[model samples]
Target: MIPERVLLTLDLPDEQASNQLGEDIAAALRIADVLLLSGDLGMGKSTLARAIIRAMAGNPELEVPSPTFTLVQAYPTRVPIQHYDLYRLGAPDELEELGFSEAIRDGAVLVEWPERAAEDMPKDAVRLSLSEKGQGRTVSIDAPVDFAERLQRSLLIRRFLDDAGWQHASRNFLVGDASTRAYESVCRSDGTAMILMNAPRRPDGPPIRDGKPYSRIAHLAESVTPFVAIAKVLRDAGFAAPQIPAADLDNGLLLVENLGTQGVLDAHGIPIAERYIASAELLARMHMHQWPQRIEIAPDAVHVVPAYDRVAMAIEIELLTDWYLPYVTGTPTGDEDRAEFAHVWEQMFDLLDDAEKTLVLRDYHSPNIIWREDRRGDDRVGIIDFQDAVIGPAAYDVASLAMDARVTISPELEAAAVDAYCATRARLGVFDREQFETAYAIMAAQRNTKIIGIFVRLDQRDGKPAYLKHLPRIREYLSRALAHPRLAPLVPIYRKAGIL
Candidate 1:
């Protein structure tokens, strides 16, 4: 379902007049679930955003900075706003690379000059248009389909005006529920407003399975309890963790404090290497934390990757052998290669069994970490996507980061990070440092192999060719891991497949 619809035509006398119009827009925004400002140059798009921000906080000095060059800017407010300028975008694929999806989750996003980014935006987004009309200005607003009733009932609008010491302006404005089930709007009788979100729910990703089994697993309540408990344990240890304010355990509905962007993977921009090291240090910290007796794995607890079992592993391998191999090279895999590949997988499994295991973030890569400037020390890394966390080999997460299945980390940076992580482990009381390194190498090789196969599948089966773009980098990581003596034995198999 999409949001409500509201169309408003505003006439402004001049650039300065846009501020008062902005104030009205801000007032309208209090009730509106999301506000979209669209206009051309000299049309005062930024001015309108500033006024709304000012009106929301009733603080005239609040800066509504333009995100034109930065791509996006997130304001710190009781109800935060995310501003985006997509005029300079070179391509739609750039959205994922720039991390726009994650930003939308944390706060309301406003985009200026959005024509180029139309393809990258939400399908049912609220749209607005601004144009220069001689000395005056004209503004047009279009709400998402069917959002009228909800917008009119929006709690934020009712509370905002009340807080500003005003009576309930008619409840005539249209509104809708927060974009996702995780977010809920709450406004008092006054105009004071804030959005409450359920922290337990992670963003919905590509469906990993089909039918009822996956359907049951996708719901927040079924999936979030374990991770919430895990975060509580981390929080007790003085780490920054997701806070769960309220939840119906059976239903999965929740109200949570918005933590803002502070995840490790969310770190970006120049000095990228420095941000990576910081994330590495935080992972090391989590790895070194002594597992408390209270947290025990239930025998029936589901595996993070449901398909990680023996049968699933075989199916994945078959997908590589039968589908990926032929499609990529038009050369069918021989029976002999299949036998050797299975044997190699078995050997890798044995090595995994032998390694000293620890808590592992099953998917520890970019797009999960939130970056915040105010955070102190290692706590700056706001880790998310831990619902699938597992108690597995210490090297699993390290491998997940080093041979990232998503973004590539340069060899030099990866080496420095591994060293840094190992050093942190030593400081945090993990002995047998050499064993950890060896385990790390073995896991790196194993993880990258699976990723290489998966990338091929993403392209061939899922029709996502973008993954192909990163295969060479994954190969590079595999080459580096193979260089380590511990993984030297497996290099030949990969080389045979032309994966090197």
Candidate 2:
């Protein structure tokens, strides 16, 4: 009874197989009070009707002789079963004479050749048809809401305005995360239901006069198949992620299973104390997912395509040297200071290459992690904002969560979460405590430096002045990470660049 579900053609090479399938359908629809069957001759129309009357209603021995000659057959069932073949009837009067309307009102009525007497058919009855396709037969059932009265209707019909492409049916649309490019809806048709996705071909972003390096938002789903693959793996592992109902692989239109109205940060009243535990569990699971050696994505195959590699990282760092310093101290990077930054970044990038790589969530923090009301057993955290996942240091995600740029976690809670993550990793035989803590420090330091640059760029280049308010917190995390012995050398270069 799930609408919008597409039924594959039903076919059997021999008569015996066809008879068995017919019996199955009959037994399945036995409880129905009214049934109407319509199909071409020699397409096994009467064969299916016979199977239902025999297998269902405990009438295995009842004789189901063809009603074609008599036009009607009555059987004694818990609910009277009336079979009518209307192929010969030219109008409603022929069927009305057999008391077909009264039969349906009395009990279950299975009517064959309904097209002959369509006008006389009961208002509340399931309509079925069979059509030959290639070498098989396709069966379609239309159980109107009035017939079953069990349909799940939409709360609002106006939402269909968004999915105007389907004129015959309506789809349910629900709001999604701001980062989401596609809208989700569920559509019901022919007694089968399917999730639908509505995405505009054109997206709104900065004006592209000539498409030359202006900031813009574009559909980048194709560039990150690994992220989607990992989402599938997580969902398979019984974690809660946005359900992908339908995907237009070519256009990035995805119908997703709706996650209801609640985000972790929005639902919780308490601060880091209660939330950190849930965040820790999800991060631990993400890090544990196996990283494939070779990744296939559009970006990977593009020739001479730019990646967010060392060169990109260096350009990003300069935003701090260029804009952030000016924002905070009203001073600019001098020639000598720029030289020091170049030297320090080169060394930092070199040192980072030696660190082991894993599947990193890139932006695994408060903004992306949603909490579940119940925390025990399975993960209560829902991780979102993961379009930028990458194979990088394990510390990348850990640092993003612990020293979050958007939300602050107290030192005590941060230590506890780190311990929990490390413990979980050790249980999985991935890494030991000594190795994890050391790598964590280096990654944390690197993340803080990048965030400082990002905050500055947002203020000067993007005109997002509100981010400047968090500069004090960013500076705090940077200072704390710099205190580590591993980042001692890097701190002096940042200090010379006025970052410290």
Candidate 3:
């Protein structure tokens, strides 16, 4: 026998409580959701719907009237909502004429008196019931199993914001990169805006080798501790990491300052050479300093930066053979081929013996670098995505910028940026041009190899196909990097493997 589904119940002591609940739900609203609200007349369904529509529109004063007479009212909000009132319906078949199914296809739907047409509702539709209580009201939500956790998390964020003194802030979802973390832009009535980072602790996958997950071996930041520690350090060191206004470290939530919307890319999504050079110069200045391996989030909590050792680099390169090569050629790799690939990278790792080491922001690419024109000098480069930092070759970041992961970098522009970085380093101290040259090429190839596999894995395993569009660019970047004379030993290997 199957168990009965459990519904989440909440008590609303006043209109403010109901509004907050509605706002929280609105924040997590997605296209194709059917919010079936069931309740009697005067049970505050309209009030809750109004709050949700207003929150989604990002305008608290937006007019949202009852659709009782019209049958349905569509609002062009962030997630377009179709508000429906089946109370005065002539028949259940009228829902088809009212465009209920059509609304579900285009955007989210909120329906009152859904029981009038219960058969028309989708199986996955979220069910909400409102009823009167002692001097207040109670709401019970029964979401589809898959959506229940997301609803709880969004509500938790609402509570977090309220506790952090941001009760009046309006929320709008912010698109993030290919990561599990989510972001929201919260603005107050006075036009004060801040970013809310919802970074939950991700569980590790099954151990692939030596009883450790790839995340652990590759030194991926499992919690926000690295971010908090690095942000404080970057701010202290005269960089542009966002300020943390409030934090719930235990719950993996943080309210951060809003760095400008501008990034290293232009309006057309192309890399700006001038801005790239400026960012490179900033990196030069960063490498000149002797950064510590241990970063302090608080006096009691310290995060130790991991070293980018041969093991870590080798594991990353394996992605090419494990996922990317298989995807590109549509053939599973044999043990012999995998062993040869590992051998090639192992031999190439020795070229970095004399490479300069510093705090390597592993993903120092265009997407992570914000261009703040209002600031002067290095301050213009606002670094926001650096949780996966490591104590590694300084040349890695320069390569990451010059041979960007997401955008195409022309050879002329790449050379100019590298020249700017070298010039800036020369001005500060005696720079090792020869050593950096080889290290940059090796790091570039390794990064692209890993990226190629990650993109394939994202599409195949994670069900995100957008990253696949960048595979050709990544392949081109890899070929360019592999051309460096320092990597000649592995040239034939790449050619033989059909990955060149």
Candidate 4:
């Protein structure tokens, strides 16, 4: 007993408008959901289906031949989709011969002439009915119970846009990363563009310690407030973080300035030296500033920036023993071995007791950095993905920028970037290159080790296997960092863990 909770109607004045509507629906679709397109022959049903297929494939010119003749067609996109035309089916049971069940399990199902299936159609399927209305077409959408919430979310975006004075904005899906957050590019009627951040508050998982979830232990941002607070700090310091135009903090939504997609990486996806050097210099500049531990959200609201303390660091590295070691070795880690691992990390953490602490943007790499060529000096770099900002060792972000896990930063280039940062600090005041090098090496090893575990956890627990591809690169970074003499004490432990 699925309930029809929301019914939406739209008037498409032209084929362009119809196609845009199709794209919008495609963005809202998820795996296993069925979309039934109901319309009479030549009522633009196929045209809308083609638009959806093309949008999902991210190729405007993708060949999406109608399934009218073949009965079924599958497209391999980010989310695999099965397109079916039941118009020519001899009987409803013929769906079994066409692999309807398997198709639904694989990805989303788009069916034309679903009426032919009648009682055989899934009860939870979303139905869209189209009809000719003078010169334009009218569409009525009946969303099933499961889809009702998604429809609500879509309407929330519309409402947010209306409030932001961009009611007529067209949304284009943007790239998402290894977080719960998603984004879209909203193009206004005047051709101006902004970014919409959809970061729903995640419910806490099973308590890992003291009735607190792992996120609490890791000081992960539970709401959009941290992002807003951190962005303000960065922008006020003259950095290039996006300006928030409007925000629905309770809904975890924000319409922010669009920092163009010119990244620090080149055509080959490798880090460009000049941009990397600039990023390191930016980090140096940030380290010099005395950032506030707590940020003001509003007159009555304040966001306390968490310290990256020993407990947080220790919990992060536990991912190695908790997920990575077992994944790579095909065996669970022993309790004794886990104890030894913790002991090694505790000793390493002791060295950072008096290290220079500053606001560390945990993921300060090429992916989160936007290269604004028109801007000069530090402003040329636009930073994003800083919601997990912490008051920690300045070396952590430098390590993140240098030993970037996503892309291979050549040893020569890494050294040059490090040298540039050190040079900047030297020009400012007294700088200890040797002491900083030790901190850099230690942080790099710690960060890379954490990433190894995080990647494995993402694959095993989160069902995102794509991150596993970066493990080898991270392993190399860890090895290079562990080679530092100061980190020598933990060498045997790493070897024992089979990570070195």
Candidate 5:
């Protein structure tokens, strides 16, 4: 029996608006999902499909030819997509010959003339019917349960934009990271752009310690409050954090300034030395400030930034055993090993407790650092992704930058950045190079250990295997840090776990 569908109708005023709707639908598509486009010839079915394919491919000029002759056209993207036209199909059974089942196995499928397939079409497919309406078109969508939810969310975003006086703006989906948040570039009719941050309030995961989720224990932000609060603080301090023009804190949505696309990385994906140095200087400047542990979000509202204390650090490092050890060794962590791991980490945390504390933007790596060439001094490096910011040891962020997990930092460049940062601190007042380097080594080891488990968890628990490719690089970083005399205590523990 066919299930009842949740229908949504939109009156697209022009081809531009129809393309925007296509982009919106494309952003919601997941792998293995099917979009069945049902419309008469020249009823804008191919036009809509092209928009979706182009948006997903991240190339506006991508050539997406009609699949009427070829039957199917596949595009390699972050989420692979296959566009199919069944207008020339000889029979419904011919789909099997054309590898229809295999085509949607690891990617999305957009089928035009879906009626030609009749009962062969999956019941879960999202069906879109377009009809001519004067000079434009009207689209009616019959969405499955999952697609219905996405449609509702998309409608909410449109309403929010309308309320914010950007009703005619076009939205292009921006690539997202491993977080639950997503982003979109909203371009106005005047060609100006703003970034839309779609961060829903994160629900607490299953309690891992003391009836608290890992997010709480790790001091991860639960909503947009931390981001809004921290961005305001950074901007007020003359740093280049985005300006929030409109926000729906209750719904966890925000429209902020679009920090240009120029990043700290070069075309070859290597970090630019000058940009990294500027980033280090920005960190030094940020460290020089006396940041409040609590900030006023509004007249009566307040946000208290959590401290990255022993418990938080311990929870983070525990990922090493909880995920990575089992993944690499193919055995669950035994009780005895767990006890030894805890003891070693406890000792390490004791050493970290005495280090100088500052507002540590937990992730201060290349991916999060934007290079604004038009800006000067500290402002030239625009900072983002600080919702997980915490009051922690200053060396934590410095190490995060120097031993960047996503990108390789050469030894020469790493030394130069460390020296530049220490020099800046020295000019400010008192700086102990040896003590800071020791702290840097400890933080690097700790951070890399956490990352090893994180990458494994992302592959096992989240079904994202791409992160596993960086495991070797992270292991190298961990090895380098553990070689430091201060981190020797961890060497035996890692060796015993067979992770060395």
Candidate 6:
């Protein structure tokens, strides 16, 4: 029996509406998710399944034949989709012999004739019931509560796209990072593709420190306004931030230009030295410019960039005491140690008072950088995803690049990237190499410490254990940063925590 909870009951008045629903489902699909398509014969079940499979594969013309004789067809898309037809199943128990369980475990599954193996069919799978209504069909979707909300959001995205005049664009899931935002690539009829960013307003988490949420303390972007404002700022500075063509400011949806797929990393996911150097050069070029403290994202709409003050920086480092330390030491950090850690970090921040200040794109790392081979010089680097930018020391972003949080950079490459940045800055104008180096070491250490804690929190609180594997790299980066003589006083604290 289907549960009382029904996500949506809509009429697929035409093939277009039905195909749009299929695209929506594919966009919201997660790994190991199962979707049961149920309907009477000729209810367009196969057509909807083909629509879904093609959307997931990002190929509208990919051949998706019925899996009746073969019983199953698996396409190795990014999330991997498996199509199954059980209309001719001899017995319910035989479902297992067809590798049904294994297929469901590996990736998303779409099953037709689920009733043939009703006893063996997974109970938690989302169910779609379609029935003929005159010349069209109506569908009732029953999904788990959390998934139901996701579907509702996906439908909202469709409406947003429709309002933007791209009603029939093909959708494909791009990437959803460790943030609240999700992204999709929508291809128009003319073959132009754009990024559809689904960054809803960030809800505040429970007040963790100083009666403010972690996002507020960290100066994270709470709404799409920041992204729009920051994008304008970067583009005005001559950097290649994505051009936002359409924005539903109230709804947190945007259709942006598709920056090319190439990035600073190679096919093997390792950092390319030349691209890294070019990215560093881009940062140096950006730093030499004077950014407006308040940017006009739209006429009469201004966004003021927040200052990355000591409170925010210090509170960020406390993630070490609050999350990472306890995970490693088997004990919650004492208040005394927390106080000392905060104090040392505050003192380090004091050094930044004399350092040059610029727009610190809080995450100037590899994931957000797009490499354009066709572009010239610094234009080769495309910067995206910097809604949390702040007015801070010039060295912070340099540190973000040198001690990349996602991938390990060899010592030689790190030195080369840093030197390339220094050379670029020197040529741009008067540059203080010594001061920048001092701040780089301290800021790099501070950022790495916060990342180590965040990775642990992602594992423990967010149920994402994959981030744990990067902990060692983060720790090593932190140690390398702490080795700086200017940060010598803070080394003892790390040593006492057995994190050196």
Model 4: per-residue Cα lDDT over 1-500, one tens digit each: 56655788888888987777766777777899898999988788899889888878867689899899999999997678999999999999999999999988989999999999978888878888999999989988888766767766766786788898987677767877787888888886577999999888877989988888999999998889999999999999988899999998899999989888899999989789999999999899888999998899798668999999999999899999999999978999999999988898898899888788899999999889999999998788999999999999899999999999899988899998999999999888788788889889888988988999999999999999999999889988888899899999889988877777
TM-scores for all candidates: the values are 0.54, 0.54, 0.92, 0.91, 0.93, 0.92
Model 4 whole-model lDDT (C-alpha atoms): 0.88
Ranking by lDDT: 6, 4, 3, 5, 1, 2
List ranges where model 1 is wrong by over 4 Å. 1-222, 248-256, 262-271, 292-323, 331-336
lDDT of 3 by residue, 1-500 (tens): 43234589999889988887888898778889889898888889999999999888877789888888999999998889999998899899998998888899999999999988888788788889999999999999988765677788898998899899998677877765677888899987788999999988867978988999999999898888888888888888888899998988888899998889998888999888889999999999998887878987787879998999988998898888889878878899889989888887888898787788899999898888888888997688899879899999998999999999889999898899999999999999999898888998999999988898999999999878999998888878878889988899888877876767
- Give one digit per residue, the lDDT tens place, for model 6 in 148-212: 88788899999988888898888888888888998898988898889999999899999987799
Give the poorly placed runs of model 6, Cα more than 4 Å off: 1-4, 13-16, 61-63, 69-82, 91-107, 117-124
| Candidate achieving the largest TM-score | 5
- Output the better candidate (2/5) by lDDT: 5
- Tens digit per residue, CA lDDT, model 5, 1-500: 87767988898878888777776777787888899998787789998999889878767688989989989888987678988999999899999888899888989999999999879999888889999888888999998878888767776787788899888677777867788999988888788899999888999999988999999999999999999999989998889999988888888889989888899899999889998888997898889998988988887657899999989888889898899999988989999998999998788888876788899999999888989999888778999999999998999998899888999988888888888899999888787778788788889988998998999999999989999998888887887788889888899998776667
**Poorly placed runs, candidate 4 (over 4 Å):** 1-21, 39-51, 57-77, 93-102, 129-144
The residue pairs in collision within model 5 are: none
CA displacement after TM-score superposition, residue 362 of candidate 4 (Å):
0.6
Report the candidate with higher TM-score, 2 versus 6: 6
- Name the TM-score of candidate 6: 0.92
Deviation in angstroms for 224 in model 2? 7.3
Best model number under lDDT: 6
lDDT of 2 by residue, 115-195 (tens): 776666666567667767666666666665543322211211122323533333323223333333433344434533333
* Positional deviation of residue 453's Cα in model 1 after best superposition, in angstroms: 3.5
Instruction: Report how far off residue 205 is in candidate 1 (Å).
Output: 16
By summed lDDT, the worst window of 10 consecutive residues in model 5 runs over: 18-27
lDDT per residue for candidate 1 within 63-123, as digits (tens), equals: 6677778887776654566777877877878877776776666656677777776766776
